[model samples]
Target: MAAWLGWQIESNWADPFVFAIYSLVKPLAGALILVFMYAVIAKDGLHSPLFPGVFVGNALFIYVPAVLAGISWTIIDDREHYGMLKYVYTAPVNVFAYLIGRGVAKAIVATVAVVIMLLLGTLALGVPVRLAGINWLFVAATLVLGSAMLSLFGILLGGVTMITARHNYGVGEAVAGGLYLLCGVVFPLDTLPAWLAATGRVIPISYWLEAFRRALLGHGTEAFASLSDGVLLAVIAGSTAVLAVLAVLGFRLAERRARAKGLLDMQTMY
Candidate 1:
C-alpha cells in the first residue's frame, strides 16, 4: 500500500528530475507561504520569536490534508475509480486494517513533509529550530500519540465519506480547513474568539499541537503548562479509543447501507 501510495504521489511526471523537483516544491511552497504570512504580520521577517513556533505549527499542519485526503480518497479511489469496493468487501481481509495500512503510508509521507519544512525553514527562511535544545524522546512520544489520533480521525472521516457517497475531496478540504483555523496550526488558540476557543478544546489536534510545540521548542506558555505531558497523552489516548469505536461502527453501518442500496459500485457523478 505504501509503495502504491508513493507511486501515486510521484507518478504524474515521467521524468525523475521533474518528479523530484515537484515533490520538494509542493511542500516547500506551502511552508514558504506560511512563513511569508508570518513575516507580513509580524513585520520582523525571520527574526520574530514567534517564527519558530509558527514554522513548526505550519510544518506539522501538513498532516491534516495528507491523512484526511489520503484516507477519504483511498476509499473514493477503490470504490468509484477502480470499482473494487465490492470485491474488497467480500474478501476475507479486514477492510479497516487495509485502511490503516493506507493511512500509515500517508503518515510516512507527512513525516517527509515535516522534514522538508524543517530544512527549508532553517536553511532558506533562517528560522531557528534550535535542534540542540529539543527533547528528541518527548518529540517522538508526542508524534506517536498525535499520529494515532490523527489517523483515527482520518478513519472517521473515511467512514463518513463512505456513508455520504458525496465528493470526498470536498469533505476532506472542509475538515482540514476547519482544523487549520481552530487547531492552532499557525497561531495560539487563546487569540481566537471565545466560541472558537471552546470548539478547539474538544478537538485532539489542538492538544497535539500544543504538546508538540512544547516538546520541539523547549518552552511552554501558561496555556500549555496547564496540561502536563501525562494529561495530554491521556486525552490523546482516550480520543483515539473513542474515535476507533466510532470509525468501526460508522464503517460497518455505511457498508451495510451501501450493500442494501446497491451503491457499493455506484458511479460517482462528480
Candidate 2:
C-alpha cells in the first residue's frame, strides 16, 4: 500500500540532510494501536477482546509499522550497528524502564501525527469538525489514559512477541488491514452486523473510540447517561491503573528473559 501510494523511503532525499519520511500518518497511528492492543489483552484477557481498536491498530501497522519499530531501528542502526546493544542492555536501568520510556516517546510522536492529521483535515481539506466541547473532562481523560493503555499493550506485544517474530512485517500488515474493520475508527459499530458489533465491543479500541467519540462528538451524555459520572470515571481510571502495572510487569519479564538469553544483542531489524 505504501508503494502504491508512491511513498519513496530515502535515507536522504534530493536535499542532503533531511530524510524523506513520507506517509508517516499511518505509522504514527500504528504506534498508538500497538499500545492499545497491549491494554486490551492485559485487562480483558482474551475473553473480552478490544476488537475495534485491535482491528484499526492492526490495519495501521502495515508499512507504518509501530513507532516502537522505528525507535528500535534507530537504536539498532545507529547504536547496535556500532555493537552498542550489549552495552545498553547492561545498563543499571531495569528492562521495563527502558521499554516504557521508548514506548512513551513513540506513542507521543504518533499522537502528534494524529493531531497534525486532524489539523490538515480541518484546515487544508475543509473538513468540518465541530468541537461541541461537552464533557471535555472525559475527552481529556480519554486522550491520556486511553492512549496510555494502548501504548502499554503495544509494549506487552513487544515483550511477548517482539522476540522470535521473524514475520513482523507480515503480522503487522495483517493486523492493520484486518483489525480496523472491527474498531469503528473509520466506520461505526452500528453499521456492522449485530453479532459482529457485539464481538467488536469485546475489543479495546471500540470501547475507547466509542467512549472518546461520545465525549467529543456530544454523544456521551445521551448514550452513557445510564451510568453516573463516577462510574465512567472509575472505568477510565481503572483502565489506566491496570495498564500501567501490566506494562511495567510485562516489559520487565520480557527484558529479563531477553537479557538472560542474550536476545537483546541478537540482530533485529525494524
Instruction: Summarize candidate 1's per-residue lDDT along 1-270 as a digit string, tens digits.
Output: 644643564354467667556556777887778777777877777787767777888888888788766777667777778788778788887777777677776676577778888877777877666789777888888888777777777777877777676666588889999999988777777788989988988898877787777777776444467788779878877887887788778778877877788877777767
RMSD of 2: 10.5
Q: Pick the candidate with the highest TM-score.
A: 1
Clashing pairs in 1: none
lDDT tens per residue, model 2, 111-192: 5455565454334433333566557787677667665665565565566553543654444335534446765554456678
Error of 1 at 158 (Å): 1.1
TM-score for each predicted model, relative to the true structure: 0.90, 0.61
Looking at candidate 1, the ten consecutive residues that score lowest on lDDT are 2-11
CA RMSD of each candidate after superposition: 2.2, 10.5
Candidate 2, residue 223: the lDDT equals: 26
